[model samples]
Target: MVTKKLYYQDQYIRNFTARLQKSGRDEQDRFYLVLDETAFYPTGGGQPHDTGTLNGMKVHDVEEIEGEIRHYIDVPAEVHKEYTGELDWDRRFDHMQQHMGQHILSAAFEEEYGYRTVSFHLGTETCSIDLEIEYLSDEEMSLVEKTANKVVMENRPVETRWVSEEELSNFPLRKEVSVSTDIRLVNIADFDYNGCGGTHPDSTGQVSSIKMLHWEKQKKKKIRVYFVCGIRVQKQLQKKHKVIQDLTDTLSAPQEELNETATRVLLLNKELEKKNNDLKMELIEYEADSYIEKANVQADRKIVREIFTNRPMPELQQLAKRITAKTDRILVLLINEKDDKLQLVCSRSEDAEINMNDLVNHVLPVINGKGGGNNSIAQGGGERTISAEQLMDELVDHVKKISGT
Candidate 1:
């Protein structure tokens, strides 16, 4: 059985009475009803479906299946009876504005620069159209936007009518229709004429305004243009204004100077960071010199072992490197305790006999640690089941055993 599409008869039909002819569960186990007639718009042609209430039951999804529009609902309604259907007018009008705005915007590009829109999508927050060209400059997009808004402001009458295949040749259509028999055309005064099966406003002015948000390159030779229309444009502006106001309060700068002040502050931070790092390096060097003066002599090399509190592994490695670099035959072992974790760094001079990697490998297992390096340097960390001083005692004993002193 065929269901009469009430929307095509009158897009403004918000409330209607339709009797259900079929009702069943779909493959998804979703309960649905197929009415003898419906005003609900199904999901198709880049436009989403309409949602409302059927018999006061929330109709969450409306879809066309096998030439029938199914109104999917949360609860099943009485079958074979006339039920009141209410369309969410707010949502329906939003789609109408976006759909109409898209036609105008797409025509603007084709008219000005001969770029055809390859595809279109109507999203909840914004809509997009894919252009056939590989790139579109911001300046070009702005010009197209200006042209589209001009048409909108003109408030040109948008005409829609059914036409036969042979009759289609009579008008200057932007593109050919997909279906031949039940073909419909949407014409914007003298601007554009295209085949479409979506609901649209009677006048271009109802679109309110069209604003191009941004564009990015799609696949090989296509670019996707993102834009918003009507109330969406205002919502985008309000959100951005809130962010700017918060930033102005935090940075103590006017909106006009936010960018300049932010850039200057970032540069200042970088300079200060470099200065602090240089001071840290100088302090590490002084600590290294002090360790060298207190080192103990073993067989033929000096042993410098120290435990630190809340020190970083990088600084520990730098301190060990400085100590070994200043003397020819010295072994440097450093460990740092921060909270409950320990970090170890061991290194040796070019002539030192002990293999630092082997030494670290041998003792780190005691604290369930893990790390490895070359024969000269090694570092790793594990839990602090043992104190830093106890780990130091273990390292010194192993060094004596390795050196046979």
Candidate 2:
């Protein structure tokens, strides 16, 4: 026989007595108990299953499969035929508040705007509803939130009843019922009527309050609204307040002045960064000039070969550019040790006879790194199998041979 779902009869039923009609273990060796009647709400309709105790044994999960409701438990139930089930009221009531809140909020969207809810998910900490629309403006969201809270304030009775398919047309439903038989309708007084099997509170006010956290466009045309309700609203407020207080202390400004202070700080940081970059460039130019003056003259060609320990690649490039710009007669071959690897930068003055690409290509395999560039400049990095000095020596020796120096 199909197990009776007591939750549909009374959503507030926390404790109930039922006769243990069946007991067995699943493939995973998880013990399961089947009761003739139960208050446990199985996982369905986007709402998670109820978790509690059945005959002093922990009911970890409740699921309905093939018309049979199974209460998966931590251990085997008592050998007795009768069992007492106690629901975790906090989790159940929270879910009820969130589920009912969704109904009210969704109905408000439909009544005010033409937005239709395409999907709903009741997550662990928050819930979301995907609407069949591309976007929801801030003003439109505020209107829906206001309307939903108004319904909660009105404390309208939330009514649930099972009706046959023929009786469906009697009430205005938000959407058509999915089931032909045992059609359960959750009606919000004179506001909303829809087919649903999820548990809900008796009145909209019991939802406490609903808040729209945010919304984003999904799948190009749909809008997903993230929200929280009941106790979660207070929890969100507390978290935001804590963040505000921390920012106030960090910025040394009051909450009201936070926006202005943050903007000012960002602008100041940008200015400081620009100034620091200018100073770094000046130092790089000075260092590059020093290297150019120390270049070795071989066969009437100036070659500046240098090795830096643990230097960044960008700095090497910048130094090479500065050295070439200052003197067109100097060939630059630079190497640096960075991140446990060897990096090389080769550049030629416009008058130099060296081919940077050929030099880089010839040395890359020596250190197991790959790189490509034009004739004037080339760069690459590879494993630290060879020291920075070795890579620099290889490039210099190649340049010397090519220049016949």
Candidate 3:
């Protein structure tokens, strides 16, 4: 059996001696080097593996398969022969700070609120824990963070031990014990205890601080809490300060008046929306009045046609429908400002024998466009290259011919 030294004693490991037992290629055509012994911790338990140089080669990843640790490296073959390994100390210590902080926070939650940490994930940016309880109020979370930081400030010694399977029954651990017969457990004095193989700070004080950022209800019985520790807490505070400064400058208000300024901006936007809607209704009403005044009154059938100006498509379409409701022999055209596009709508009277679809088909091609519609009511839109008056005249002439007037 290969002896993994780091698993039993994480603190004593600064450097180590190892032999390259074998080398092989993985499925991805990358080299995998096996060492007789290593201080590098293979990724497990939701915590990432340690990264450093192996034998003068950059160790990109470390993984465990069938109880043997394999190091994935990126270097030419000549360098691998002169191998000397180093661990990333700053990264390792940061992991230690975060893992230790989790123990204290998890313990405080159980002690204060009787909630258990059901699951946990240690991400590169932040760490999160899912609790058995459905929710935690902001005030309660503040108390929890305050209590955890108090433990850090007190600087309680953290102890690690190897216990036999039978010895595990004597100590009360926060999580279920899952490991081989030999178990490495970490204890935060009276505050917390758990079976963990991940590296941790020697004492609570080494963590420096703990900040619980937020929490959300995951389900009826689960709440996920997000937190940062040590250097991450400092970084988070800096980010929040920058955001507040930006808000104050953009709103042109004092820092204390930021919230009120934001509320006023939102209210002003709502008032503008209401006024815009009222203006649209007024334009639609005016277009309908103009269409009625322009109706042809000489023939047996009355025909009304008007080209609308200065209106959005939606308002113009509403106007067309209103005009059609007032008179059966009506044709409404609207031109959009941006692209100079035109929309046509025609309603036929029973006495008028006009096929609106055929009329639109003939007119659309003349303006390098395309359109289609039904017999009584037809509608289409096209580019406004031709003058709106010329287009309306062409449509009126076609309607008059089709109506035999």
Evaluated with lDDT, which candidate comes out highest? 1
What's the TM-score of every candidate structure? 0.78, 0.84, 0.74
lDDT tens digits, residue span 1-405, model 2: 699998999999999999988888988899998899999999988789899887678888998987789999877765558898999999999999999999999999999997999889999988999999987999999999999999999999999999999999999999877899989999999999999999999999899999999998899599999999999999999999999999999999999999999999999999999999899899999999899888988777788888888887888889998898899788888888878888889998888777889999999999899887878889998999977887788887888778776
Put down candidate 3 lDDT per residue, 1-405, tens digits, no spaces. 363656456653756667776577778877777777788888887678888887567888988877778888764333235346688877778788888888899999998888898877888989999999876898889888889999999999999998988888878888778876668889988888899888887889999999998888897689999999999899899999899999999999988999999999999999999999888777768867776787667475556655566555566557766776667544544433335676666656444466767877878876777667687656667787788788888887776676676
Which residue pairs in candidate 3 collide? 55-83, 55-84
Which scores better on lDDT, 2 or 3? 2
**Worst ten in a row by lDDT for model 3:** 75-84
lDDT of 1 by residue, 173-222 (tens): 88778896889899999999999989999999999999999999898799
Which residue pairs overlap in candidate 2's backbone? none
Model 2 Cα shift for residue 29 (angstroms): 9.1
- Which residue ranges in model 2 land beyond 4 Å of their true spot? 1-3, 15-42, 52-65, 68-86, 298-301, 350-374, 397-405
Residue 385 lDDT in candidate 2: 92
